[model samples]
Target chain A: MNTPLLTVHELHKYFPLQGGFFTSSKEKCLAVQDVSLSLHKGETLGIVGESGCGKTTLARMIAHIEKPTAGEIRYNGQDIFKFDKKQLKAYRRKAQFIFQDPYASLNPRLTAGTIIAEPFIIHRRNLAQDIDTDLENIMKMVGLSKDQERRYPHEFSGGQRQRIGIARAIALRPEIIIADEPVSALDVSVQAQILNLMKDLQDEFNLTYIFISHDMGVIRFISDRIAVMYRGRIVEMASNQQLFENPQHPYTRILLSAVPRL
Target chain B: MKASPVLAVDNLSTWFDTEQGALKAVDEVSFQLDAGDTLGIVGESGCGKTVLSLSIMRLVPTPPGRYVSGQIALNGLDLLSLSEREMRKVRGKAISMIFQEPMTSLNPVFRIGDQISETIRLHQGCNRSESHHKSIEMLRLVGIELPEKRIKDYPHQLSGGMRQRVMIAMALACHPQLMLADEPTTALDVTIQAQILALINDLKRAMGTSVILITHDLGVIAENAQQVAIMYAGKFVEYSDVKDLFSLPLHPYTKGLLHSIPRIEGDYCRDKRLPIIPGVVPELSRLPEGCRFHDRCPDVLPICRNVEPALIGQGFPKRYVRCWKYQ
Candidate 1:
């Protein structure tokens, strides 16, 4: 647990609800309010919240896809917010994000192989020929056949498309992978397959995942630790088993009660 | 046996004639739902869950998709025989639908009030103001805050959960006898998913609305459905009471599905690794000849690969399964 990979302290993200160009001010909707958690090396910390609970916003900030309004995001003891331009460029390789919708994330025109190899082309110079071998390895790791790499996103089913998304995310071999609702779009039966694949890949790669999801069952399955968010704040953060067995926060209890009994 | 059920679908088969080949989407599926009864259809994507709902409504577009063979009897009236004009009358007035994507299901350009009121005015022959009042009441019934002001907002303005609630309100606007909810909460978050399920159940009990809840989540089905039908490769592999299906699943596929869910309750994961059902659902165009699930099934006897298993024995009183596990 001492091997902390990333630490977020008093993170805040506020979006203006209403505004005019010059005349009027706006009401601020605190999207993420004072949320703090630490991600250990090779560990998955699952974040669970309702639709507007700012989980995705928090994820975007952590992945540096969006700048935090206020907070100190420490990556390997260095404040990521205060990173120099060169250091920030280096940070992009260490933390990558896997978006929720596979179809949305991927370009329809590009082949799966091209999509996976794009990151390599962006970061590593003179890696053109190596793309094929790297792509094949990524595709195999995510349970896709070699033949599947040539196909477009539309050709594959929802589950298969998600697999390609996973391949693209892990292709860069980032230390931290932030998967945002990766399996929510999938079917219940297909969900198990994707989750299992992720678990396997996590162990094999020794990767850290900030798994974001709405399904309590899924969070329980993949996460070592769980954080329950409410309107904007994390009400409870503990081990998965502890939170599932003895949920303390009122919102957490409400969420637990709402999970459909199987 | 003397009294036929309220809704009887016998040997229902729907197919799509794509450029590739004739893909049988829903094949030889049969079931009956009495008045005020809920039948949950569970299946993986591309297993014809949506097609089943659309086929029953006779809404599958004609060019690519076709309901080739089926007898859909609603209260002893054969629905498949009805004309499109007649089906339109029966659609909102008799059988309503709450589609999966709420934002798309409701017209975006129109106001929420207009969409709901338009449905009421068209179906129930109410005036504009009257329909508006009724729509607002429906919105309040679904627990939307400030129904009057909220109903004026467009679908895009509202959050995902709010949009879903508006969709529910619109679907119930006409007070149909039976409602077909196809992955209704698939787009919403878990907490919101629970609220929507509870709302549907409350409305069903209050209005005695018989429902065919089609979803892929067993947890949602187990929570809401009294009866469940397990679909695989466009066929019903198992059907029974919810309790019975959970307690003693008759089919291997059903058992695998039930066990595969990463449950929060009970001792599910004995080992550290989650219990996973390996292999993906087969492509519809390249389906196997015999038992559809034979390839992925854990307990595969020799008979599984060669011949298809018929729905044999009333497995759990009203239960049925198309697996040799029961035989």
Candidate 2:
């Protein structure tokens, strides 16, 4: 509506395939090529693709974890890559990433409470007294009890560990979240629970989501709009209704056909 | 004329003896597959779909896993009665399996062609050059282009879809009576997945090889299998024609699984608050008494919590259910 919340124009990420440090032969691997998309203030954008299809690269570029090789990323009318150290620090407070494998994402040495509070500890040092309250509220919001705060990542089940990851992502009350295959590691029943939780949190916090997943069924459930990526481009992008009901792209139709229906 | 029964698994139970307790990974699972029939096994992870397949092939380690009881008969020969050495001969030649992760399954040290040819040589008692020729043929059957040249390539050089085709080629190398595909297409992309499924269907029809396709995706089941077995908590909740299972899912757990799947059709996702069956499945070691699904079932009754329900129904006459509500 109002110049869209975030705009990505002609974003590109390429990794050079080199022989060795001394070798002159260098071949560039195109990961994300000329990709572009935008999200409203609180809209959920579903990015669907096969493995190595550049969806993850696009998400990382949007989150500013990886700088783009070409094109523009406008976050709130400011170029994300152009931000200096201090401005970048402020931007990190408003954006967070939830990795696919919660078991691997969370440090084995850290407890659930510490993992969730790490962002606040690093960014909001002046408000250190509020960490305890912040930890409890985030825990409850993610459907985890206060007792779980003291436990390590391995002590909890896969589903519970993912809840801790979700809590950590929302710890700073970020305006946008890039969730990369959040529930792909869990069981089907547990996957449903996490999807429902994500939807509830989106409504409660009005957070914009860039959801990436290979599972079409899951993307359809939590996404407002869906973008189907192929080889290295967005083959189709439409509202969830339009994409699911009338997918124009052959790849999108094939993807929809692959998802198991009752 | 219908081909006779190839593999018949009866009341097979696989259990692991742990210090904590005895965990039954596959509890009293039984089914049969005739020639040219694809029986699809659908269930969530940890539901023993893989374990059931492994047990049929006698590949489970005896130190951790014990078959406990039940007969696994393949063409009137009891597989469980055979020695490890004897079973090894029967495996791959008579019954072969293709795993989900093909990269790990294939030996990286060897060429894809050599691997498939090795299997052919071992089972078919052919020369190196003859097996090499057959390997190329198998690759072509799996829809790989220029099998003669591609055979020399390593597993890592191929894409995920191509690696899976190599796995299928190896499984079909000996013209086995039964091929066990354990989520064969799960790791591949959607378009590639369709291609793999179609390849398996074509090969099965042409060779009259019975197939057991184990996957959680019902779409594959619908498009491939003639008979479907729905498993939950290590037991068959429902077994019916694929059409019947899709149209009238009898068990509450089966219904929940089917409903939970997001459909790309009309009016399905209207409910903004996604209908999720509450609570995670209890650990297999600590499964609920009586009906295994009673804990998470929405329509749970007192009797469902106390007594186990039996699978009862004759062929095509009526629906069979375990819940007391049906009674």
Candidate 3:
């Protein structure tokens, strides 16, 4: 409808393969190749793929965590790669990435409160006075108790740790959140809670999500549109209903069939 | 029904002596598997599904873990009473186990062929050459391509799916009567999982091997297992035929779990919020006195908090449930 919130054009990321010291020839692994997608505001775009399908790599490249070897990523109207340092900093503030493993992502030594406030400390330097209040609000918003703020990541259970991760992701109030397998590590019952929390936060903050998971049930539940990736390429992309009901690609069909359905 | 069960676990209780207290990880759990039947143990993490399997395999670490009580009878032989040295003979020959993570389960240092061949040699008492040939055959049996070449490849060189296939091949190398697959496909992709599952089913049918498939996924249990045990907080809260379990789940926890999962095939209402069981699973040391799940149960009763309900059978084709409402 309107100009897409984010536009990716023929994105590619090639990882160069290292050989023995004597070997002179150079080779590369094409992780993501010729990928193009547009994300509308407030709608979740789910990227579904098996491990090593480059879904994570794609997410990282879009988040600017990894530089694309070729092609362009446009945030709003401007090319993200072309942005200057100030604009890049602003872009970083607007787009945040939630990693797969909450245990590994959060620094074990840092207090939950300090981790949540780190983003604001970096992006909004003038907001130092309100950091504590901001951290408290974010923690409360993500269903964490106020008393748990001083605890380290290891103190919390998997679910609570994930809530802490979510708290950190939304601390800066980013418009776009790229969550990669956010609930995969959680138990089934806890997964529902986190999924619901994410949905609620999206409504509350008017957030657009780029949700990535290999679990079909989760992707089906959360996404408006779904893209099925296979071997560094998107084989199918459609509305959730269309994709699930009429998965056109052979790989998508196989994936759908493989999902252990209840 | 007259034939003796291949494996019968009676009142099996596994307790972990933690710093806090004695944690009853698997309490009074009982089940029987026929020669070729598949029994699926479905439960969330920390629900003792893993511990139950580990206990059966005699793989639970001691000092912390202790078999407080119960009998594990495999082919009428009491496994619990057996000496550690004797149990070692039974581990791979009678009952083999496939772990959740194939990557960790496999040794990275050894070639796939060497690992499989080692298992064959250990259990079958075959020579190196015979074991090597059998290893290749095992690889072929599990549907791995280019067995000769792939055999030489290390665990790191294989894909997650292929590694799992290798694990299966190694597990089945000795042709064990019983196979304990503890979330064997959990670490694999859906497509790959399906392939592995199909492979297991095929092997089970061909070899007449009994299987204990452990997973949190109801879908996997539905497709693979003939019987299903719904475990919660270290107890088999419900057990029944898979068809009946799906059609009429008696326990509140089982119902909650079945409803909680988002269905891909059936009529799925996308807008409605998933019905959630409130509260987390109780910590093992400080579990509630009566019902471990009463805190999270939707149909909680006054008696549920005070009196622990025994897992009693419902008169019919054979169904068991542990709940006040069932009583």
Measured over the true interface residues after superposition, the C-alpha RMSD of each candidate is 2.6, 2.5, 1.7
Residues B109-195 of candidate 2 have per-residue lDDT tens digits of 999999999889898899999999999999998999999899999999999899999999999989899999999988887778888
**Runs in model 2 lying further than 4 Å from the true structure:** A24-26, A126-129, A257-261, B1-4, B267-271, B314-320
Cα lDDT, model 1, residue A1: 33
Whole-model lDDT, model 1: 0.87
Per-residue lDDT tens digits for candidate 3, residues B1-327, read 489999999999999998899999999999999999999999998899999999999989997999999999999999999999999999888999999999999998989899999888888888999999999999999999899899999999988999999989988988899999999998888888999999999999999999999998899999999999999989999999999999999999998888887667554343556777778888888999888888888889999998899999998555899998878
Expressed as tens digits, the lDDT of each residue in A1-262 for candidate 2 is 4778789999888888875878865688889898888889788999999988999999988888998889999988899999999989878878889899978999999988898888888876776768988889999999998888898999988889999999989998899999999988887767878888988898889999999999887887778898899877898999988988888999888777766555
Q: Which pairs clash in model 3?
A: none
For candidate 1, lDDT tens digit of each residue in A155-189?
A: 98888899988888888888999999998887667
**Alpha-carbon shift of residue A36 in model 2 (angstroms):** 2.5
Clashing pairs in 1: none
- What candidate 1 gets wrong by more than 4 Å, as runs, is A1-3, A22-24, A127-132, B1-4, B126-133, B144-153, B156-158, B266-271
Tell me the docking grade of candidate 1: medium
For model 3 the local lDDT of residue B273 reads 68
Q: Order of candidates by lDDT, top first?
A: 3, 1, 2
Higher-ranked by lDDT: 2 or 3: 3
User: After superposition, which runs of candidate 3 have C-alpha atoms over 4 Å from their true positions?
Assistant: A19-25, A126-129, B266-270
- List DockQ, one per candidate, in order: 0.56, 0.53, 0.64
DockQ of 1: 0.56
